[model samples]
Target: MSRSSRVVFYSLSRKFVQEKQAPPKAQEVIYYSLAIGHHLGVIDCLQSRLECPLDGFNRWVAQLPSGGAARRKLEGLGRFGEICIDSTHTHLLATALSKAAPLLTDEQQSWSQRLIDLLQLIENEPAIYLMVRRRDG
Candidate 1:
């Protein structure tokens, strides 16, 4: 990205981090990440939020720490091969799945599956689908 773009991303990232405590921008981050096809960014943002559950109206927001000096560090989930998600993350992931399921194309499904599997959900597992059902039911 250009120098100005970097400044804007950092500025927005900080604003969202703060907003997460009050107004919450978690879903926006998800949609943006998805729109840009930044799969790793999607997972990182989602995982961070799962790690630190927000409260109040902004409860949906996850708290991701500020990225380091290297600009690329902020763009994707580094070392994704070693990532793991706990029960809370699984629950959140399922929620995201349900919301995005209808709009997701086959190619996007392939991308979504990576995030799902990173959270340890097996492909085409009947039990995993139950999580979304439980939420919608």
Candidate 2:
């Protein structure tokens, strides 16, 4: 699918905040595949950047209520960081986000609603390419 047609999610990393830089230009691109619903080529910004190591990501995942299920699903794929959630597993991701939202730092919580909104969108669509890219200015 064309880039313009995909649903994009942008995240600003700690590095971006520390550098005090502006968001990247719209033309800047980083890509990874995330299988959401029936879509096969969604881009995942988090995994592409390697901002958090696998161990850290695994630790965070372990804290979620549905972490075990999520971990198992992810491990089954033999991949880390990339969030390739299918329709059946949508609830798992949503539940994890809902539980983690309250524990997020104030800055992190600012985007919580947007993430929830995205999940809602996923629930409704038959296929969606969620492009999550870190805004590393």
Candidate 3:
């Protein structure tokens, strides 16, 4: 999270995006993970907003108090592993993923806006809230 780290992550993320031949799904997963912390943060956020308990509410809630740092660490390592998984694969992905790490803030902001919008809908719509709660509660 230092200035240098941001530079490195942004550089690598841009590199990955530049590769025309990398698989779209793989690239998306990497970028999404970088942006979303493997959806762990998203899940935690959603869990908190819901009136009803999700299936893993207990487990998820437990993890939330710990912060997303550990999840981000594991996710970061996983990203590196993805880049290195295939020896035959092009190195573009690896390089992009490394430099792209810093772009996470951008993704987080985008997702935050989206979550805000969605939460607003949830707040205004009794039907949706009931649906989420009746099904989930």
- Per-model TM-score versus the true fold: 0.26, 0.41, 0.22
lDDT of 1 by residue, 1-137 (tens): 22221111100112122232323656666545544543434322321221211121011211122232221221222222122333445545545654655556564455445545544542333222111100010
lDDT of 3 at 129: 19
Q: Which residue pairs overlap in candidate 3's backbone?
A: 9-99, 9-101, 9-102, 12-96, 12-99, 12-100, 13-99, 13-100, 16-96
Model 3 agreement with the true structure over 9-76: per-residue lDDT tens digits? 10011112233455766766656644544233222122323221232322222332234433343233
Measured by lDDT, the strongest candidate is 2
lDDT by residue (tens digit), candidate 2, 1-137: 22232122433211112123335662132121122211433332332212333333344445555536754754442242234444576677667667777666553444445555655666787353243422222
lDDT of the candidates, in the order given: 0.31, 0.43, 0.30
The segments of candidate 2 whose C-alpha lies over 4 angstroms from its true place after superposition are 1-63, 71-81, 131-137
**Candidate 2 Cα deviation (angstroms), residue 61:** 4.4
Model 2: per-residue Cα lDDT at residue 67: 33
Which is the winner by TM-score between candidate 1 and candidate 3?
1
- For model 2, give the RMSD to the true fold: 13.9
- Name the lDDT of candidate 1: 0.31
- How big is the positional error of residue 96 in model 1, measured in Å on the Cα after superposition? 1.5
Candidate ordering by lDDT (highest first): 2, 1, 3
Best model per TM-score: 2
